[model samples]
Target: MKYQLYFDESNKLDQPNGGYSYYGAYGANASVINDITSNVISIYDSLNTKSEMHFREYKDDKHIKKYFRTLNYVLNQNVNINIFIVNNEDAKNTAVKMNVDLTELRKLFYVKIPERLFYGITRYLQSGTDVEIFVDSSDEYEKLGLYTKLKEQMNAHSAYRNKCYKVHAAIPLDSKISIPLQIIDTLMGIVVFLMEKAYKTASSTSKIKSDLIYRLLIEGTNIQFFQKQITLYKWEGNEEQISEIPVSQYITEFLVYKTQYDLQEMGKFREIMLRNPHLDAKEYRKLIEYPNARLRMLQGYFDEITTGDRNISIR
Candidate 1:
């Protein structure tokens, strides 16, 4: 049996102050998952200081760094882990475009994280193997709008793989099972590392080497993975007009941009734009015309421009 899991974060990838990375990991055999969860929980119980399972909200860069160090230690002891990292860059960009300072951005980011890691889980029974998928649930679960949308996306991916998969949703800190919790812990730890690395690198203070090592630790465990292809469209519009759209969506879209395009692969942006006719350079420049518009444009779109570029400061 094989499993595929999917997770979504509350905010976009590059939130300035407060944003979290959410994860979902699914596996083939429930029995194996049970064992894996038990082992992980035991390790965490040994390492955790609090009597009751309590996690400190990740605050500053220092806190983030320390968390990663400990998480890395825990993961090192446990092998054969599969994880996924999802970020909310759209929320971050919205804040920046709206002139939200770092402090305010942080506040918004922190509040938006889903309470439980396994907010959504699904299971599928097939002929040879059973497939299961977990998703980070949105606050709007009652509406069933977002949940349906996510399931649709997952089903599409499953169809592409030509496999039968099931999906389920779990609440954060729910006590139905311990193994899922352990998996969630391990997955969260890995996401923290990836997010911290990405955040630090963006801030120009990265201290880690070997991004591939981190990817292996986090994403390599999953049997199958799918990500939304993000395309950034820069339109010629006034600040007021751009601000009308929620900042969160903008940041989410940008993170998708950054994940797909980095400094070494900068040329890929042009290629993407060429393929996506709706996002021509002229339209892009026009869409982003506010203060630091260029920087905002590149935050999740292009990879090289920084906060201090002359073009961004022009207006």
Candidate 2:
């Protein structure tokens, strides 16, 4: 078996913890990568823009629609999406505990995210499979060392050495033209956005919303894994529970704990959209513009959710 994993990072704005808080990868059989490219191109063809599709540039309803359609297609395919998130607070604590400088600790923790993501991918290989991994190109100096570090780590791991013939070193590719990278970019963006929501609210509702897509994809499947590790300094009001869980145990617990309640909620949202597929954006704009716009905008949301249409009677 041969696999290709395309990875990208999110929130790479030179933060204290080496820019990105999350790194993600989309992995699939090397043979089927072309099909993935074709599907993404098909969506691009429907749009009027000639420029590349980017997560940051997704600002309008049309862009949102394209993102969902493309993402839904990707999730339904034979691919795996794994994200490794760095808990900023956890890193700070770990740095302090180890008597290390925060800046050096941040860089070390940043390296660990990709290493863990790579390990998650390569650990599942059968006796004869080889893997190739690509990450979106970046100018950061740390990225320059990832390839060598990953190769050394894979070779050093006895499980990987025995289960697979060889693992190619991870390489960087320009996301501007790489469809697989773009797909992963979109996913990383969504995952990061969901994480932000989870951090801000600290509620089960937010957690469910964040995991909804992953739960839906993994239902009735036992031959796959969606690896997630979050070492938050705090969780569910427990600040002392900052230890990291083992990866396999974490995956198993995630699969078991997730319920289909969200599915029903998701189905309701689906129904609204399907029923009001023709709702005009202009109508929404009208309700949101001019006189007492704030109050009207609030009412617009209520009306849209209640009636499943943007044509609200603002009486």
Candidate 3:
């Protein structure tokens, strides 16, 4: 079988202290893509909106309702979604520790990040399957020789070396025509919104915390279909340093311990929304009170519920 991966990114690296941003990719076979694309076009027909679907541009109730339907389709589809979030502050610290200049850091963030994402997807490919990956149109990689770098990283994997899988190429495509890329755009937006909310939220005891700690917790159960199939990796430096104790687990446990009630309430609300489509005016009002409030608050709650407080490290 042949597979195609559609990827999109949210936010910019230059935005210092920008809470969270990600490069999210959606992968599936041709059959699944055709189905998803048909359903997406049907949604546009129903809404009668010529506007292209964009996560950040979704504002009004009508737009948001349609957006939610699109999100529901993504959750139910036969596809794999993987997100890699990089904090600006963390990247800076990593750069300082590794003694890398800004140019090197940029390559690591834009080029190396996607390469790791593809590596995670290799396990899903079987013998005789050819795969092509596309990202949203961008020129950042033009001078960096993205395709060449990607081949080097992808070919390094044992599966590719053993001829168990074939990578066709990496290319950039217009998001306007690719429904899969649009889906990834929404996915990345939701993850970023959740992380931002988590970072901005204040603790009960008024203690300061590291924002990166909340990154792992920004996962959602809607995509649990791809949970174990997906890998979330962090590139801190060139050399891997093993921590004596799993401090990340402790941080996750503390966050979950602190947000139990909020998570339960969000779960109950989610069930209600899913079952009852005709929410009252008051509910709609609540959803629109703040900017991206519904997605932001609910995702933060979902992240808390879905976050795994375990010990796992990537090399």
Highest-TM-score candidate: 3
Name the better of 1 and 3 by lDDT.
Answer: 3
Expressed as tens digits, the lDDT of each residue in 93-161 for candidate 2 is: 666788887666645644445545655555676766777777666767344465665555555562534
The CA lDDT of each predicted structure is 0.37, 0.54, 0.56
Pairs in clash, predicted candidate 3:
none
Candidate with best lDDT = 3
Query: In model 3, which runs have C-alpha deviations exceeding 4 angstroms?
Result: 14-21, 97-99, 109-111, 158-163, 198-231, 236-315
Mind sharing the TM-score for model 1?
0.36
Where does candidate 2 stray beyond 4 Å? 12-14, 17-20, 97-99, 110-115, 142-144, 158-161, 198-284, 288-315
Clashing pairs in 2: none
Model 3 clash number: 0
Cand. 3 TM to true fold: 0.64
Candidate 1 vs candidate 2, TM-score winner: 2
